[model samples]
Target chain A: MTTSTLTHLQTLEAEAIHIMREVVAEFRNPVMLYSVGKDSSVMLHLARKAFHPGPLPFSLLHVDTGFKFREMYEFRDWITKEVGAKLIVYRNEEAIKQGAHPLKLGVARCCGALKTKALLDALEAGGFDAAMGGARRDEERSRAKERIFSFRDEFGQWDPKSQRPELWDLYNCRMHEGESIRVFPISNWTEMDIWQYIRQENIPIVPLYYAKERMMVKRGAMLIPADDAGNLKPGEVPEPVMCRYRTLGCSPCTGAVYSSANSIEEIVAESAIATRSERETRIIDHGSNSMEDKKKEGYF
Target chain B: MNTLDKELFSAVETALLRFTTAGSVDDGKSTLIGRLLVDTKGVFEDQLDAAMGVEDKKGAKGAHLALLTDGLQAEREQGITIDVAYRYFATPKRKFIIADTPGHEQYTRNMVTGASTAHLAIILIDARKGVLTQSRRHAYISRLLGIPHIVVAINKMDLVDYSETVFKQIRQDFTDFYTNLGLIGGELTFIPMSALEGDMVVTRGTQLPWYQGQTLLEKLETAPVTGKINARDFRFPVQYVSRPQTEELHDFRGYMGRIESGSVKVGDHVTVLPSGLTSHIKEIVTFDGSLQRAFAPMSVTLTLTDERDISRGDMITHSNNLPRVEKELSAMLCWMHETPLTPGKKYLIKHASTTIKAMVTSLDERVDINSLEHIAAPIELKMNEIGRVSLKLLKPIACDAYANNRATGGFIVIDDFTNMTVGAGMIQ
Candidate 1:
């Protein structure tokens, strides 16, 4: 007979489900920052589990950076309907109008103007009192200090030094007006946990993670996807290559590895022995303290 | 399933060991965590190379093992961890989650947060300074939190010339002080180690040949984790009501929540506390499918054959075992903010999903964390101070003792004016 003890995956799932319920019970108007990545997919599944037989209490908000891959859009639309989630999409139109491209404006400026600013503007306009993201502590070093219910100022910036002391499972969700909390349901889960949960639960993710022949242009050890011209540098020509993305982001900034492992089984096996950190592939993460800098600017 | 997937699934079935490292600065907590990661192959080549590059910046000779865990820019700049950094490592036998916490007195709240859910604690004592105040403070807090196991890891043995007498003296001192606290037995463990020299951490290095006990990793892998997590009377605090009212499931009404303790199954008679209504468990619903039985820490939606006024903040329990409901509460409180705790100020007491206005009517006494002595009738509890207090609540709460169950017994005090969490209270 199997023992009553919960597996590691089940433990992570339980913690995440508890967080979802807390947000719905505490906040006035809450929303989910659905990035349509593996983490987001697992979070969406957990949310549904948290409030089964009832609609998800919060709306799913996607801050479109105007630079995601073509597959991300399709996946977003399909998954939202599949789970019957209330979906909201927003973007900073001024940046798109003024031509704030990644290469032209540079990685830091482009991410700040297009991504972080867009998220801030969306949160403000929607008047959301709480927002949940799939940020895990294992992803970044600074995130290791993050509280489960991370408090944000009126400007939506995180203060690492003065975080409220969270003891036991009793998180302090009390906040004044205009000040919101960024709730990370899966703060304890690692990257391997995510893939394992996804595989076990059969949660659907973007096919961009699977290996296939794709049009890419090599740019300094990175396979810049040729799906968008903005991703290519000047003298770069589109070529065919077999690759898959470890982590997804802006089409211009995210990098793809030369991998032939296509199935979920293959990916998990390959990742078990893979040496590179998942964040290493993203161009924005190359700069020292870029993640902390972006987070201070209200980036998710 | 394929061969690789099956192997991974079997590995996932292993229990996760959650432990916290508590020691003052220079006790080499970070070095121990770094060596554990390295020995387990948890650190990648790229990460090692990155740490190697920071060796010079940190002004160390070799690859500073501390640099592997001191991940933040501020931590590296100050050469001390400012917050709890969780590190993960797995040997084929088991997986470990290290809550590497800072030992500064100013950051005691961080350590409390880290120790809240830990199954075991590693209270490191520098062999040079036998049983310092910080070590005793940490061990006392761990005991108060009801952590099942405590390992007093006597570290920095190399600096103490690996003298068995020094290690034994510190261990004996810790024992004498720890036993007088009237704590439960079979919870204390002693081990001698040198984190910087990589002795008795993950491996039994040759330097500590005088000691024959198991290494740190071996102890972790084989330690009988003691109490069961879900063996108790059922307590499920209703978190949300779920009713889709769709055509496929028209008359569906399920109350969703995570079982804080114990287990429940279909046809089990349960009583909804704070209402005194009885209902039978009709169904247990999950996204994947329905579970025949569910236990603690599992999130599930349950439907009852008899419907009553059950919503968020209401608890479901076995009919024979009901919790005490009272308007007056006596608890041990840990102050967490700059604002001092006054006797007559109004504050919001949040227990589970219920928040009630409460006032501290009496300040009984404070515990001197260092000497474990009582300071009677303290004026107020400052930041990081633990004391006994009496509170009068406007509304009654159904609760059990913290020693009986943590979820129902623990509460937080929210400031009336700022709404910030100011204190943590454990129902006595």
Candidate 2:
């Protein structure tokens, strides 16, 4: 590579490392929120590089809604153990016991109570002052206005309309007692950038992202995986087909697209030609501007 | 793949600089972004394929460069960026994060949001329309936000027939306006280009034979990044106090936080803010190991030689120099809420390492964007307006001037009842 190109890359890396350091420096009792997704994996990897020769300064916080694909759990465990990070799994047993399924409570309410509320409760219980997330602005509308050092109230709610003006590289992470900050180091990353980074870094992702033969049923524009979460309507028959999930969310909500590409290379090639957004395939988001509604309730 | 990997690795090493593109609807902001990506080969094959599919359906012109940023279905159908779209690209020289903000006046909030964290602001001015109201407003906002660099991309040169006279006139106008606003600290470079025909974007164009300057990509790659932020006074807000409370390191006590500015060594004398408690640095600890000295933007746990009363929300700085701890502060605030900020309104004031209840003591003045005048009689600041206001904090909060220390001087006002961020203020 030319010296200038190398220098340019160094600049991006330096900024990311700087932001990671800021996260470590500003918040009291901070933790890295890991979703075991590709973006989260990239975040985890970046944190490792930010403090090379040392382990991650913070623990990993995962809010489990009890609706994750089984493969995601395996990837989560492997990553946690590989990084030697203390993992805190949070779940709202009350919601689970009350049988508040995605179909019953709707996607927004289910995510709010099970994921958002559970995360808030976890922060309160653990007394974590900040939580690092992998949310990128390119993902949704409300996320576009988020600050790098986003502040949350005592109730763990996000006020999208009123975000602190983050100027230059200076981020204000200070908050009152009981309030916490949400740090997103990869807020500038786009979907294509993430895929490119994944390819470049050779980051190991879950196999579910790759196309595979599975029994699925078509629901509207989405292909529903014939798993336990698939609440089949009367006379709905499942057929074996090659499909892959562009985005990994709750099984009940996340939709699959028909594809023959099964490897990372294939996935990358296929993703380039795909016209629809990653969220368009997700059935949950189709219900009601899913991300916007969830973000209002503090869902990261 | 190997070339791509090497490029990605190199891009990650540099500190990424975000910039915004501001121009009128027909000035070619979208086409500029499209050309940059295309010439640099940043657009993936699949992306090109997708664009081709869209092109086939619509039979549009100019390669649909706007499609590179307008990712949303609504935005694609409308042919306007309603919200800010962030696009990333890297060259051998530097990595870039482009906040492609819309030019519509209604989307002023989106522009502010995009320009807030940007280090540089690229103001696109069509040669035909020289220094319009929106261009001036954007340039003023860029200066107000303290963007250190400004690149005036004189786009649509093809339309202007690559006339140096037109480029010079427009350049002179912008320089005069920017200088009047006291934005001379940052360097300004003007380049004549056609985003549609790809002149001086990534490669040197033959059309602009008289223009002798580096391509946009070259300028971006070689531009000096603001470096060595540790020259100022050290400010580390105590995020938390880490005490393992375990058997192996039972007596371990470390003050954990990120260093906002300056440097901290093991033997330096530091003072804790608010309490004014002094202590000598004992050790600089990290998860991997201990460092002898830690500088700005590094997150590390500090163990003081003398254990004083240090807790979260407390600032640690050099013992010799300290920030002013005051209850009443004068600031320039950007009112972001629909409900205008009124005098005597109680709000949550969040400053460096601390949050306190504060009231608007007075509305000093509201800035008139078009004229750059501060109207004192303006009673209220509507949404997306800049104004000067005085705030009275319930308790003393430490602060530095926004010009000196952005980390300490900057603050946000939160609505007490709604828990929404109402406005952002820079201490005067």
Candidate 3:
């Protein structure tokens, strides 16, 4: 049979694998940031394919924000055991001790303390030189301009104006001792691409992505899960609704959309005609430059 | 609601085209991209509503389209893009990745970075400006970067009264300038467009009845890609070695890497460079399944029939066709650092999968951007300056000319102290 040219998905997969190998080859100690989301699921699948026969050389790092949905924790543990690689789960113990929740301290302070600050502290403690993320350019406006092998200073700050000129696949991974690099292997894959690849590879994802009848509380324009009824205010009621989350984040900061897309195929089709971006469901990204600011402060 | 149809899923498997846009700061490059995204239905309704609500800072009417591409906070505040922001949009026929580069003269390095991997480049020429120096400069850089296809779009025709005479004159001038650059053929095309009015970009908006040609989107959808790289000699730079070292697979050793160019198959005779050892492809392995053959850009593991002494940085090629193994060579180098590149400076030259210490022997000549003149024997190169330089590597590395196979031809120069990529080179 005559060989055929590769489809876009095939090409993207190849490029992503090539990038993963390059990171392992160049960096001293690398780690994969596993968020247990769909994008992370796809990244983990590619990582396994990138180095077959041989076990994974790098460990998976999960910065647990303590406020995530309970299902996410279960999936993370199950997948970590199946991958058979070392898993490092770091949480902000001080914040948890101080009872710092999104509702109490506000969204900005809560994310900054639990997610961003905790991530930096974990990387420093582990002495990791390279951290890999599953961030895609199509996710947000700021990410659309980031490099594949993004450089960060000793403080883990991202300078948007002074990025290195990345050319072709020749990623420049050299940096000072105090500085580090954040490599994104799936930087080119869009949301639809992630779902399609997940379906194609039969990769397992968290159950929260599909719609089901669940107890939800109405908050302004969003449907928040009624995980804890004690946090409700006056005139608030917990009710069952057919809803699904387009993204997975802190339970208080992530909202679910009303939909009946229970399967991967339906989600793919719904994404095709969806009027709002997936990030619209992210409550913390209200300001136009919120993501950019958080990134500068070392948020993944 | 649109359900998952067979045809819509097939669109996900279509060909992908990667291109870049180039023009002066005032040439509406961003506006053209916005128009493309809007017409292709790539923009979401929320994004449109937000754009329409942006506080018309510059008082440009109707949704400051330029704001769409300037994603950085500083760029928005300063009202000028400073880096290469990538954008994605697709039609049912093809998917596109647009590297939207800044047009300021100071940001030439960003433009070069954007154009390095592009299969095609759209050189925008403002119809009223009529092919200024910036237009010619952009065209020159696109040609230098070896972009296979070029579309010279005469933009803002609405401001020029949709004059056919202006469009023809600009096209003729651009052709003359490009012909003078020693590259000529069917690769160059021209399209008269008004991005603000949305003419001849995604659709033929009935403005230019005299001009019967493919719209910009049509040409982009149909442009050839990947064939340009796959047509060259087979080059595979080994990136890593995979060894299971387990009881079940104690003797398994696989060379892992992507096919930089050309194709490879089982039972094919190949040779490892720098060692001159011969081997036959025993098995082509992938997680999906084993294959009889694989082409360029596919990342696969190949276990050779013979256990040759091979490691990372060593190249594998067909036994008959080979690359030049040399220590001293000349290349067109683009300086990307603020510090001047003095002659006789030693730096790290990363080529293919190997990094070696290299020294610049001499600055042969610097190509003046404005006039395309070669200034002989320049002492040093400044930021964003393009020049020809001779380099001597400590170890001999296999290389192909940049024009032949871009995968193996390009290299980046790294500074020793800062460890940043300071220069980009294309072997001559």
| Model 1 backbone overlap count | 0
Using DockQ as the yardstick, the better of models 1 and 3 is 3
lDDT of 1 by residue, B16-125 (tens): 77888898887877777777887777776656666667446446522477788876677788887888777777665666778888988877767877777777888988
Clash pairs, model 3 backbone: none
What ordering of candidates by lDDT runs from best to worst?
Answer: 3, 1, 2
The prediction achieving the highest lDDT against the true structure is: 3
For candidate 1, lDDT tens digit of each residue in A1-300?
234777778878988998898888878999999998888998999988788767788899998888899899999999899878889999889998999988898888888888888888899999998999999887767777788899999999988777777776777888888999999999988777888788888889999999999999898888888888667777899999999998999898888999998988778777777776787778887666467677877877
In candidate 2, what are the lDDT values of residues A104-216, reduced to their tens digit? 88776787788888988988888998888988875654465567788887778777545565544556565677888888888877675677677766788888888899888
lDDT of each: 0.83, 0.74, 0.87
Runs in model 1 with CA error above 4 Å? Answer: A1-3, B1-7, B48-63, B224-230
* Model 1 residue A245 lDDT score: 93
User: Least lDDT summed over 10 consecutive residues: which range in candidate 1 chain B?
Assistant: B54-63
- Report the Cα lDDT for candidate 3: 0.87
- Whose TM-score is greatest here? 3
